[model samples]
Structures are given as C-alpha cells and as structure tokens.
Target chain A: MNTDDLIDFLATRVEAVDPGRQDRLLTLAMAGSLCLAALACIFALGVRPDLLRAMGTFDFVLKVGFLAAMVAIAAHGLRRAARAGRASGKLLRLALLPLALVWFAAVMQIVATPATSGMATMFNDWFVCVLAIPLLSVIPLVVLTLVLRETAPTDLHYCGALLGLVAGGIGALAYASFCVNDAPVYVGIWYAAGLAIVTGFGWLTGPRFLKW
Target chain B: MSREPDLEALMRASQSGDAEAHRALLQHVSVRLRSYFRNRLRRSGAGTDDAEDLVQDTLLVLHTKRHTYDGSSPVLAWTYGIARYKLIDHLRLNARALRNVQIDEMDDLADVDRYEAVDTSRELHRALDTLPRHFRLPIEYVKIEGLSIAEAAARIGMTDAAVKIGIHRGMKKLAALLSEARP
Candidate 1:
C-alpha cells in the first residue's frame, strides 16, 4: 500500500483501541519488570555479598551491591515501560536522578570518616563511612521524588522511583567496601566526582547504548 | 529510515527480561501495525468507525499472541500477520451487513457523504515530519502511542508542563503545516 493509505489505516485503528485495555497491558508489563528487579536485588545482596565485599569493605560491599541492584531494576523497568509504549529516553533521564543521589550520599559518608594510617583506624573509618552511606542516602530518594512530581499520573514513574531508591542504596554499600581510603574530603569529592563521571557516561552512552 | 536496528542487543535484552527492550519493540512494531490496518480500511471502503474497531481488534490479538512472535523473524512482519487477519475479519463482517439489506433499502449516498471525507493520513504524517525533532518525538509518544502527558513527560525526562506545552505547540504547528498542504 502507498504510505498515505497506510497512515490513514493505522490512525483509524489506533483511535479504536480501548484505553482501559491498553492501561491494563502496560501495568502487567511493568509488574513483570518489578519482579525481575526484586530477584536481581536478592541475588546481589544475599548471594554475592562476598564478591561485593572484595571490591571494598563489608559496608562498601553492601553499597556497591545496592547500586548494582538499582541498575538491574532500572533496566527491568525500562523494558516494561517500553512495552506499555512509554518513552525510553525520558525514563533513563528520570532514572539518572536517583543514581546521582546515591552516589552523592556515598561521597558524603566517605567525607565524614577519613581513613587513617593504622589498620584499626582504616577499618573503623571504613565501617563508619559504610554505616553512614545507607543512613544518609537521600539523592536517590530526591530523584525519585522529582520523577513522581513530573510523572504524576503514571504509576510506572513511582515504580521507577522505588526501584531507583533500592538500587542506589545497594550501590552505595558496594562502593564503600572496595574504595576506602584515608581522606574524608577525598572520598566526598571523588565519590561525588565518581557519580558525576557515571552520570556523564550515562548521558553520553546511555542514549545510544541503553536503548532497549 | 534513520533509526538503527540493534537486533542482537534487543534479542539479548528480551531474553534476559529487559523491560526497556520489550517496550521499544512494542512501540516500534505498533507504528507499522497501525499503518497496515489503515491501508486495509481504505481499500475496503470502510468508514472511520470500522477502521477504528479493526485497529483495536488487531492490537488485542497481537498482545494475546505476543509469545508467538519468534525473535528470529522481523517484528514488523509478525505484527502484520495479526493485523491482516483482523482486517479480513472486518471485511467479512461488513459483507454480512450488506447482505442483510436490499439494494433499494440502502441508505442514501448523499446522507453519508460527510463520512466519505478524504483521508488525512498522508497530510498528518507530512505535517509530523515537518515538526522539529524535539516536538515530533513527544507527539509520537502522546498522539500516536496514546500515552498520557505525564507518561510522556516521564519518558522524555521533562516536566509535565514542558510536555504539555510541547504538545500544544506541536499541534498548532501541525495544523498550520497541514493547512498549507491542502488545496
């Protein structure tokens, strides 16, 4: 068929679609993603803690694990969002806020407890920083809030926001374990710097590489 | 024509239960399916009402039989098969309706003349193409995909106000472009 004829036929058919049915399908697809994200979280936290700890300390391990989980969940959410005919670019952009927040909080913790020369001081500082990452985790939470505010009608955004929080929390824990050092300022600056680096990577590569 | 096909990556993502890949596949295929149904309706001489029902039925079938869509084949072809079936069903239904009425009992052509208005599909697409990329993408999601403003906003990383404004302005620009194209 000619392009014009094709366009007319599609527009008519699309208009005929039942709004309720579309909504239901979208919801079902998103639910599937949520299930996947949950499984990923369990795998990262429960099954692979030691591997994550090897990256840093126990606390750092947990934070990294959390971030890894968030990435997994966001990936899952992106799939569901696509099936429902949601925009992928916007979803990823919205996802960035939470990732940014988790990274920021982790940096803050490292800043508060600078590692010292002695093994005891290093372990103590590392533990304290790890503890603080989860407690002061707010960037992901804030990012989620912004997503919610922007996409008020769709429950999918909320799903994304919650997934972000979980992912960010785990990520922070993981970073704490592997990257502990002596300077709190270095941790804070570099951690924030690290997140900024990730954000840049996500922005530059996310659009091209992450399209599902 | 400009969009790249990352079939291997898409398949891997789908297999691994990547939600974004699945969603992208649906959106990409749905556009082609709409085109398929639209063409059939025009050829069949069906009015807008018949066309709309046909489209909805096609989508329902697609969703139900999504598992049958083997990743090995082109997604568009798979979607077209389902759409073709729905169109044939519509034609059959119409034939039955016509048979029930005698030739002399048929409604006056003049009375239904308004329903026979020229299809604006080409004009719409042309107008859409003329839109700036920024405006066009949102319109594609909101108007074509039938997503709500909030949903579109979330997907594009813009606030609700921005999406709404973009759609409004886009519609205005589309109207102008279409009007200019009209004889």
Candidate 2:
C-alpha cells in the first residue's frame, strides 16, 4: 500500500489509547499463568507433607524468596522489553544482586557445614528438581509467549529470555514447597541449573517467536 | 519541517482518539520515515522502492504499538526506534536471502532488467487474505471500507470492543505478513 494510504488506514476511527493496557495485560497473564503453574506443580508433585513445618525454616523461606525476587525482576525486564527502545542492560545488572546474595548465603552455609553433609544435601533430588521445574515452566512460558505476541517487543531476545526466567522462577517457587532439600547450597546449585535451562530455552526461541 | 514538540503534541492528541490529530501525526511521521528509510536504503545499496515499503511497515508497527508510547520519551525517538528496527530487519532478511544465491545466479545478478517492480498493494492484499476471518473482517471494514468501529462491529456481529481489538490485532498480523513479504 502507498504510505499515505497506510496512514489513512491507521488514522481512521482511532480509539482513545490506554497507556496501561499492555502493562495490565502482561501482569494479568503472568499472574494467571503463575497460578496455573503453581496448581500444576501442587497436583502433579504433591506439596511436601510437612509444608507448614517447612515454612518455618530459614532456608526454605530464603529459597522461596529468591525465586520470587527473580520472577519480579524478570517481569520488570519483560515490561521494559515490551516497549520500543525501552530495554536496558541495567535490569540485568540489578538482577545480579539477588544472584550474589543467594550465592553468598550458599557459600556461608557450605563453609559452616561439613563438606560431606553439604555435598549430600546439594545432590538430593537434583535430577527431579531440574526435570520437574522445566515441566512446570511449560505452561507459564507458553502463556507468556502468547501474551507477549500481542504487544510489540523490539528486543525479542531479551523479552524471550525474561519470559523464560519468569516462567522458570514460578516453576522453582512452586517446586520449593515440594522440595525436601532446603539447604541454601542445594538451592544455589540445583534451582539455578533448572532456571538456566528455561532461560536458555527462552533465549534460543526468543528471536524466532518474539519477533513482531 | 515539523518540529519534535509539534509532533509530540500531535501524538498526545492522537492518543485521546482524535482522528484528525492522528492523521496529522501520521502524515508528519510518514514524511520523516520516508527520508529516514531513503537514507538508510541508499547506504545499504537497496532500491528506493524498498524504502517506501519499509516506511509503510514501520508506520503499521507504530500504529499498532501506539499505546506502548507511554509519552516518557520524545515521539521522534519512539518513531526512530521502530524505524531502526524495521530497517535492520529488512537488511537482515535481504542478507539471508542473498546468502542462498547460487554461483551460477551470481552472474545473472548484474543484469539491470533482472528485478521486477514491487507491487506493494497487491502483496498487501495477498497478505491480508492469509489472516483469520475475525482479524481480517474488522480491518477490511474499518480500514478498507472506511466504516467506523461501531458500524463494522454491527455488520460483523461482534461487540464494538471486539471489533476494535480485532482491528488492532489484524493490523499487527498484517504488519507481520508484510514484513515476511519484504523483497
């Protein structure tokens, strides 16, 4: 079409633009997907039998909190990625704080405990943790990808990667309740590994699917 | 030449559903994009006709993504961002296609008559036909037939909001289709 014709096409019958529409849509979609992931995790894996008892522990709270923080950061980054020219490298830098904090806690815990005990806790259910987290992430990742296509994202790679992180974070959080390994070292290793897999999935598929 | 502030004001007014303001904003934007694309295309050794297509593609993206403007940045900056993305995308697609040229075809590439003029509207219509009916009808009615959203909604038997959404989504899908069709 001619440029003028295209202009006329777009300018006709314009509606009042809702500035918050994308933000609202993304937040609702993410919330709904996270809820779906949580439910799926609960039903499929079953929550740890001593769930209430686990909630009282320091390591459990830290583990859950770490995942929650990652999700929040990724969501923020995703919001930035949705807008044209708004993506910033600073968000990635900010995310390093949480990474450093979790690793610091893990290191301290490792140093405090005997090497044998720390290593044993770190490997508990490692296989199940990695596999199950990605499985749980499937719903949120797919949902977020679909929702993301409705908005314009220039940095498809960043946007896709953030979606993966958000999905993975939710998956990890859901898995936290069911996980028996509460050691900071275990969380620092196994949980990070699972999240990285999802994030890698996002990074690889981002340029293909997020393009629009 | 339209000043940035004037364009920004037009953008703000356009956001409030003022069709005239939107038209005015887009006219200015089209002028800017034409020159922008022309310069970039010249630099990249691409045809000026491709610039026209890129201008239209970027405009479509801007139209569909207007709500993401947020007004925190200059309107031109936002426009330039989308324009840059379209330019890069076009160049990248061209490069990929160029990579597939056989050594035998390389000899024929020097022929002046080898290229055909791009028929944008025909291609656009072909692209539109590929969209789902729900997404296509609202665009055909409101954009092509020049019907208002309410009128289109009534005829399509969808709610007005649905019609609006359909048009928005249809435009996005159309833009994607156009992008894939880029020469």
Candidate 3:
C-alpha cells in the first residue's frame, strides 16, 4: 500500500497508449452519431417538400455551410480539449470564427433586405429551428459524453461546452435540409440560440458528469 | 546511465508499455509530487499526511490519464497540470467538507460535552466491524488508516474504481448502522 507497491501495481498493468487512439475514437463517434442524427431527422422530422428547390437556393446552401463549419471547428476544439495540457486560447478563438462569420452575414442580409422581409425571415421557422436543433443534439451530446469520459479533460466546463457545440452543430447540420427557413438571420439567431441552450446545459452539467 | 534522466524519452517508452520506464517515470514523478504537495499543503496549513495522500491520488490520475498526453509536449508539464488540478479539487472538496463539519458542530454545540471522542471512536470501530469484508476493508484502509484510494485498492487487490465504490457504499451502510444503534 506504500507508494512503491502502488507504482508496481500501476506499472505492471500498463496498457500501451495507442497512438492517435483518442482522435480515432472521437472521429468515429462523431461520424456515427452524426449519421444517426441525420437518420433521426429524416425519419422523425421528414425533409422539406421542396427539397430539390431548397437545395438550389443560396440561403439553404449558406445555412448548411455555416453549420458544417461550426461542426468542424468545434469538433477540432473538442479534440484538443479531450487531451491533457492541450487546451489553448487559439482553439477558442478559432471556434468563434464561424459564429462571427455567420453573424456578419446575417447583418449584411438584414441591411440589404427590407425591414418587413427581415422580420418575416427571422420568424419564418424560428420555433422549429430552436426546438429541433437541441432535440437532435441529444444523440451526439450523449455520444460525445460517453467518449469524453474515457479521455482526460482537465477543464470540465470548457470541454463540456465544446461537446455541446459540436453536438448542436451536428444537429443543426442534420436539421438544415428539413428546415424551410433558410434566411441568414434566421439561421444565425435561432441556430446560435439552440446551440447556446445545449452549450449552457453542457457547462452546467460538466462539473457533475465530467468529474474524473 | 546518463547524468540526467530524459523525462520525455522515459515517458515515451512508458507510453509504449515499457514497465521499467513506466516505473522509473512514476518514481520520479512521485518524488517530485511528494515535495510539491508537501510545500503546497504546508502553505495552506495542511498536514504532511494529506500531502502523501495527494501524491498517491495524483499518481493514480496520472496513470489513468497517461494516454491523453501528447508525445510532443513536455511530459513534466502535463503531469504537473494534472497534479495542480487534483490539488485544487482536493482543496475545494475539503472546504466543502469543512463547511459541513462546521454546520454539524453548530447543531451539536449544546451536546458537545455529552459525546466523548473515545466513545465515538469505539462506536465507529464497532460499526465498521459489523459491515461485510468488501465494505469494511475499504473503510478501514481509506478512513481508519488514512490510505489513499490507490493504496487501499492495491492493498485490497481491487481496482481503484471498485475501491471507491466500496468506500461509498460502506460509508452509507456504516451511517445506517450507527443511526440504528444511537437510539
């Protein structure tokens, strides 16, 4: 029970650290969970009736593009956060870039479009967007939580918020095709709000669930 | 042997399952942590026993989190980061426990002279003896002997996680037994 015996106990049971194992597991989990989220969205929510037409629209493309970027950045941040001593400020700033970009685009669109149309665009599917994004994020959030528990995350709240961001981004990406509202302002505000809800939830639960 | 141990190389070898390297790395870290924790705990007006406990706890965490270490980073920095986190967490938990003890002391203030320390110790041992082996061992090693969870697990030949669970359940059972015997 002394430190020597404890060292022997630990050393003898040494499991080789597989190189890139963390990244592989995280990537696989995110991909698989994203697929599941997409399927859930397709089956549960059903695609928009003008699926082909919506795909051709610039707004639809922009919405999907922004969500995809957020997912990629947040996923990268999550990867860094999962490891010990790798949490960095650069990653945080990088993660915020997509939000900044989307918000800027939203502002530009709001300025160019008429006031009445701007209000209509924002409210078109605001309710559905907010409700569905967080609902769909549950799968990825659960998956990420399970994966993260195996890895060491020193900053529980930060890692948790990143988890929620990645999960919600995946959810938004999955729900993008099904949504009828493709306006930049709507996507910017409602998507961010939905993601914020999940992120806040993650931050709150991080200390509780992510405790090693 | 080189004049200075290359921690990075040792850690790299350790990560690849070299037992000697792993042992050496742990011993090196343990020595450093003992002093580090001792100084920090002293600064905070805590005991050397707490320092040893923290050393073992930090070592266990370091072992479990070894896989998360990026090979390129300085191994000592990563180890110390985990140690600092463990120390801070321990302090926070201790603070909360101290607060609870204060509240309990307040409640027991009127009857402070009624319960003797010797009687309480005897009652606690009696309660512990009545519990089953799995539960009893954890409490005995961790609480009575003041061993860290890793040490208790090692002595009991159980996994650390199992030892933790055992202590938790044992404490609950002990509380129930004590409450039942009180009246």
The prediction achieving the highest TM-score against the true structure is 2
True contacts kept of each: 0.00, 0.74, 0.51
- B58 in model 3: Cα distance from truth in Å? 1.5
Cα lDDT tens digits, model 1, B1-183, are 558567445534543444456445445555666667777777778755455445444443443334333344455544554466456545764665465445543465642332232244234565587688768867778767768768888999988778766765675565434322321
Model 1 misses residue A46 by how many Å? 24
B1-183, model 3: which lDDT tens digit per residue? 345488889888988978789889998889888989989988988666667666767776677667777775687777777777777777775675467567786565533432342255334566578789999998788766657779989999999988877875675565444333321
Best lDDT among the predictions, by candidate number = 2
Model 3 chain B: ten consecutive residues of lowest lDDT: B174-183
For the record, the alpha-carbon RMSD of candidate 1 to the native fold, in angstroms, is: 19.1
Candidate 3 or 2, higher TM-score:
2
Which one is best on DockQ? 2
The number of clashing residue pairs in model 3 is 0
- Tens digits of per-residue lDDT for model 1 on A61-94? 4444435554555545533432322323445455
Q: Give the fraction of native contacts in model 2.
A: 0.74
- iRMS values in order, in angstroms? 12.8, 1.7, 7.3
CA-lDDT, candidates in order: 0.46, 0.82, 0.77
Q: A1-212, model 2: which lDDT tens digit per residue?
A: 66777777777788788877888888998889878887988888888998899889998888888888999999999887877867466776676677778899999987888888788767777999999999999988888888787676777777788888999998888788688888888888889889999988998999898887
On lDDT, the stronger of 2 and 3 is 2
